[model samples]
Target: IDPGHGAQDAGAIGNGLLEKNINLEVALKLQSRLHQAGALTVMSRTSDTFDSLQTRVSKGAQASADIFISIHANANDNSGANGTETYYDTTYAAAHSVKLAQQVQPRMVSALGTKDRGVKTAGFYVIKYSRMPSILLETGFVTNPIDASILKSTAAKDRLASGIATGVSNYFDVK
Candidate 1:
């Protein structure tokens, strides 16, 4: 599991919520859930620390992770751009990455009741170079009032974490 940004890199900031903080919180929750389901997890950073993109990819490669999921909150100059989306890169593990993204995308929308921005292809540094199936989840747009409200709620975060965990289990056909 990789939380998007941290420490000096606060990621996107909006509505008084730091994307880094939310990313870490959701990542930790998802990690706990995955652990309960008997999945061995590796986190890029377990605390409020920063790691370069290459470092994150190296950690996953070193651990021989089956799948790499990076958690992040989105932001937009236009606050009206609000929704949940998942991204996958075609450079490596393309098909599996798409499948993993498809699994997580709707679960996020269902969990958060946000607009479904759908799964997309992107060349993000982490997902692009990782040899394993990889996905980056834009949980919601923090700049939007509705989405921000949902993201700021503790109960919603738990549901979002559960939704993501379920998606991973579905991808592996595991309980």
Candidate 2:
């Protein structure tokens, strides 16, 4: 699992919340959930440290992870843009990545009850370069007031983690 941004790179800060922190919080929760579900989970970063995008991909590659999930909160110059979106890169495992996104996207929308921005195609470095089924999730926008409030809640973060872990389990047919 990769939680985008850290340390000096605070990602998107808005409405008194940092995207990196939120991403890490949700990822840590996801790690526990996946571990309980019998998956050997590996994190790109477990603490408030910095890792380059290349390093992030390398970690997953070195581990030979079956799939990659890069978790991130969204931000926009337009604060009105609020919702959850999942992205997959077609340059590599097109069908697999899209399938992963298809499974993950609705779960996130349902979990957060945010706007359904739906799954999209994007060439984000982590997802694109990783040689496994990969997805980058935009889990609501910190720049938006409503999303910021929801992101601030532990319950909301738990819900998001639950949704993602369930999605991964379902995808892998792990019961």
User: What lDDT tens digits, residue by residue, belong to model 1 across residues 92-115?
Assistant: 989899999988899989999999
CA lDDT of each candidate?
0.95, 0.93
Question: What CA root-mean-square deviation does each model show from the true structure?
Answer: 1.3, 1.3
Candidate 2 residues lying further than 4 Å off, grouped into runs, are: none
User: Against the true structure, what is each candidate's TM-score?
Assistant: 0.98, 0.98
Residue clash pairs of candidate 1: none
What TM-score does model 1 achieve against the real structure? 0.98
Where does candidate 1 stray beyond 4 Å? none
lDDT of 2 by residue, 1-175 (tens): 9999999999999999999999999999999999999999999999999999999999999999999999999999999999999999998888888888888899998989899999999889999999999999999899999999999999988999999988998888731
User: Candidate 1, after superposition: displacement of residue 88 in Å?
Assistant: 0.2
